[model samples]
Target: MQQNNEIPQFDLAEQIMAEQRKNASVRRKGPAKRVGAPNQKRKVEPLGHTIKPQPALPEQEQIIAEIVARDIKKLCKGNARSPRTSGF
Candidate 1:
């Protein structure tokens, strides 16, 4: 029986992996810890005065009507016929 001079492939690979793992753990050690403020829930305070709702503008209705019209036009363009002119 003769002793082989070279290490087996799996053995060589395992040695490399062990070295890598040791280096990784050494690098993972971080700086020393320091004391900080204790974590506490924030305290929320109510507003000193109540907020009143603003009155609606007279043009708001017209602006909303224009938006609906534009959306309808877009929907109609995607389809074969407009619902307003379509016959059921």
Candidate 2:
């Protein structure tokens, strides 16, 4: 008895790529709408006459000065410290 053997006629990779192309072409874009300009424009300040600055309260100014003094003391103390280990 003789038996005949034939290879299957199917390609998995080609079928997958064809399916992807079919899906991409079926996409529909949404409807377009009309757009209008902004209702109000921003105010432009003059070169030298910019925004006016508000003065800080006396109590607030004293607190801010004390905080700044503390920060300076911390920086000076850190710089005056000696290294724990000496290197060659």
Candidate 3:
């Protein structure tokens, strides 16, 4: 345990997540970087509605959403650009 200064059974990637491990100090990821055409507008998806294309929740956005939601009440207040209520 870190209480003993043990190298945690998990590491930087293994702690946050092996799946989330990054090679660079900054990481750029997700569908926009993978599929979407740069500078294009974000496509819309309706609940239970699937368009002819697209994967569910790009990994990067999902991570970013989680980070934003952690302090959502603080980060999103008065930011009308967001589509959903912060805790909605």
Candidate 4:
């Protein structure tokens, strides 16, 4: 029967991995948990803006907004998309 070098190789590999992990750094991000309901809560506001209710508008504004959105879609047919529509 013949012995093998595999055991020492395995030990060395484990030691290298442990050392690397000890020296490595990682960046963490975002909230640890959901803060609030997506639709009901506003995202954290930028500087100078506070979380506030969207204003109440006359019924006419809704229709005008829709019409403008459609015109924007038409005008944007070939342009680079804004972040709002591309989602990143």
Candidate 5:
């Protein structure tokens, strides 16, 4: 006896898919709807006019010490020294 390798279900599926592709090609699609205002231009503000003036930063050493002290305090939890005495 010889075994048949052909699949009948796969052949049917292929035929159905071909028909769907033909139908889709014949269908008409409308133009896409506009999302936002296309004609309006964005208002530009002068540089630094909208931003509030920031205070001058402390020395680099002071900044580094403050960050280190904060991290140490976090790690030590309740054992860390008070902020006033720590001089952070």
Candidate 6:
């Protein structure tokens, strides 16, 4: 029995894939650029005249407002129970 010392040869498909990988690595060394459409600077236009924002309400007033809103919501709800009219 005789053993060969030569390196094993890759098949045609394996050779193509190896070549592709080698080419890909070579390409990765350089900075990549976009394929199409040159970048344009967009002009930002102001939408109408900006109105001055009103000052925020005081903390105490905000709390009172929230309470009033909640009570109003409860009264507006269709499922809210009405006071019993029958005398017990």
**RMSD per model, one decimal:** 7.7, 8.9, 27.1, 15.8, 12.1, 12.3
Order the candidate numbers by lDDT, best to worst.
1, 2, 6, 5, 4, 3
Per-residue CA lDDT of candidate 5, range 1-88, in tens?
A: 9999987556878899999998997774545643555877889966865777776567866898999999887867744554444444
Candidate 6, 1-88: lDDT as tens digits: 8999999886999889999999998776544553656688788998899899887679878999999999889765634465543333
Candidates ranked by TM-score, best first? 2, 1, 6, 5, 4, 3
Say which prediction, candidate 3 or candidate 5, comes out ahead on TM-score: 5
For each candidate, give its TM-score against the true structure.
0.34, 0.46, 0.19, 0.24, 0.27, 0.29
Model 4 clash pairs are none
User: Judged by TM-score relative to the true structure, which candidate is superior, 2 or 3?
Assistant: 2
lDDT by residue for model 3 over 1-88, one digit each (tens)? Answer: 3467566463665556645555442476765666655797788866896568565678978998887887776566555667565545
Q: Name the best candidate (by lDDT).
A: 1
How displaced is residue 7 in candidate 6, in Å?
16
Tell me the RMSD of model 6 versus the true structure.
12.3
Runs with alpha carbons beyond 4 Å of true place in candidate 6: 1-10, 30-49, 53-88
**lDDT, candidate 1, residue 38?**
85
Write out the backbone clash pairs for model 1. Answer: none
Worst 10 residues of 6 by lDDT: 78-87
Question: Which candidate achieves the best TM-score against the true structure?
Answer: 2
Can you tell me which runs of candidate 5 are displaced by over 4 Å? 1-11, 28-49, 57-88
Q: Which whole-number lDDT from 0 to 100 does residue 28 have in model 2?
A: 40
lDDT by residue for model 1 over 17-84, one digit each (tens)?
Answer: 99999999887755565455789978899889998988768799789899999988877785655556
lDDT of 6 at 19: 96
